[model samples]
Target: MATKDDVSQSARGLLKKVKQRYMKSADFNGLHISTIWNSREDLEAAAELVTARLVEVVGPSDYMNIHIRPWPTRRKVADQIRELRELSDDDYGVCLYPRAKALKRTKLPKKCEDAPFAKAMARGRSTLELAFFSADVLESYRNDARFRFGMGDFGINFWLSDEAFDGHQPEKDHVGLMHLGFAYDMRQYDPEVPNTPIVRRVAAFYGDLDDLTPEHQQRWASFQVGDDGIDPHPVWYASQMGHWPDGLGPFARLKPGAQSYQRLV
Candidate 1:
């Protein structure tokens, strides 16, 4: 089990870099999705829609764990990782690719309890990573049954796991360290290839920032509003990419080609 001790000087540098990028992104809504509460019916319906779509992407399985954005208590997602795939070495800590630009470090923010992402921040032994993989590989493997439902090898989590802890935190016990962000690698995909699975894009926040005297107006980051008592059994996020309802409006223009599991597939 990796821990704080495992965090090397180099690793800390990268973690800091990763957080900075996320902080900037949290404030960005242009290509971002925000969490919205769902009615019991809406929640169930959304889950059904999300699950149906996921099944088409990776197929079905019994041990699968799902996280709805902003729902809290996420799965730790270690077993979901496979050996680093096709991505290049330079892609490791660069959270935003052609989409978002990362900011350079200036003065560090004072650690504060109220700051978003304070608890779930990566510290100690955990280092961030990015990966790439194919859908055919996941479908062919038995252990990969749950992966289709999880942030996959090729996704942006390949950019950096949306959530990561220094130690081995299993999916069920995921608390305190709530890393988020799971997007599709829109840049790479092949409709004709079975093995060319869609790469899952991923990134996360390390709730470790502290700005005792925050600016009255705006800040660099914003997270799902709520207390620490978020439920992890199922986490929720807002997305218009696939066939899920996230209260379309500004996000409606996303045009994931209309909802439907088969269409998403």
Candidate 2:
């Protein structure tokens, strides 16, 4: 059996490797650790060992971890929209697209008029869907079996460190570090497994804003959101806007006859 000191040493080595690899790779800020190691067990074991130290350095509320499973079919997205429509309040969601132009027209395209996800982006309309529903709704879904392996497709975390620490903090004053979680990468889009659940935890180390390079600044900003922003599908209108939410009203009128998930491959 591995001694406790051996395990800690191994975990420290893994953390150092990931932190270095994460900085060197483009867009690796929020990429899942599993993608780097190709093993969920390794990611979990590493997280278990270092998470306590991270908590000591980073505050609990400053970090986030989540499992995001994309809805595979258009029908599934439509069903979710129908249920969301029943919600009376729209505070959790805000419209972020077409910010350049105001809604000059109130009508949506005929082909997408009836689509549940379609929303008229006229003035004062909130179209993006926020994952704000009750937990019971997820529990009631029949496709719950897919949640096991399918949900954790991306798993990662992020941390901040200055040149003084060289991306590794001292034993003391490490409480603010917490586990930052998963994100979606459009390049990994698998048509056969469109709904594959992603499990990601992200941790990054950065110096003060003044010390960061321009590229580092951009990478730092991108991970603040939960997505990598590389999808090309029209159905991914919202994801293109940075894992925000899909906006179909504009796409429908602009690109008629286009179907959801049509260009995913």
Candidate 3:
């Protein structure tokens, strides 16, 4: 009676359990990147459109550690946005610039503010992403907002490198990864915990990730992401900042639906 999709999901569920058992056994030593974006097609189109610009401004590099991720804003974080916006301009300039700018670009109906659904927020759509580990690939975007949204409905993807993911344990890698993600998602133990769908998916899927071969690890080192996550820009800042769109947000105004929040409805 099970459909192909159902069968596949069942198999994946079993695999996840097995992986969890492994995680409990070994120390995890590897880097894992969790990325969010709208869709694969949109990601490709956006990446292709900007590839030329990134090369022109940053110059071609043999390798760069860049991750294209959307702003982690959802209707759930409205209060966070308000709080960040309230901070002294100098204290919060990084979080407000893009959001207020993007709001100007969109013709949000007056009613959009009160519905409590994503449709009511300035950018309920999961279009813009942040957290490129290294900026050389798209450095120009650091200052200007207009240049970011040139590709309509653009989203980005991040790659995982085993080199960045090392620790004393291999079996425990997925467990640590899941814990880290959950810690980020928890946001100070706030029960609302937004983006449940996507977050859960990452936790479940991580159990199945394969260990990177040595050649792959060496290839990743070429990106030279020295001490990034420790005080990682974009990631650390975005996590602390709360809302999705702001100075860090690309000038994306279309405001597409958030992938994780959609499933709850």
- Highest TM-score against the true fold, candidate: 1
Task: Please give the RMSD to the true structure for each candidate, in Å.
Answer: 23.2, 25.7, 25.3
Write model 1 residue lDDT over 171-253, tens digit each, in one string. 43222212334434544457776676544433333221221123200132442222222222112232212334433333333
What is the C-alpha local distance difference test score of candidate 3? Answer: 0.25
In order of appearance, the predictions have TM-scores of: 0.22, 0.21, 0.19
Best by lDDT: 2
Model 1: residues with Cα > 4 Å off, grouped in runs:
24-83, 88-241, 244-265
Q: Candidate 2 vs. truth: CA RMSD? A: 25.7
The CA-based lDDT of model 1 is what?
A: 0.26
Residue by residue across 22-99, what tens digits does model 2's lDDT show? 233332222233223334444444443333322011111212321111111122323333322332333121111111
Error of 2 at 69 (Å): 14
Per-candidate local distance difference test = 0.26, 0.29, 0.25
Per-residue alpha-carbon lDDT of model 3 for 25-64, expressed as tens digits?
Answer: 2221111111131233322322222221110011012112
Residue-level error in angstroms, candidate 3, position 159 = 6.2
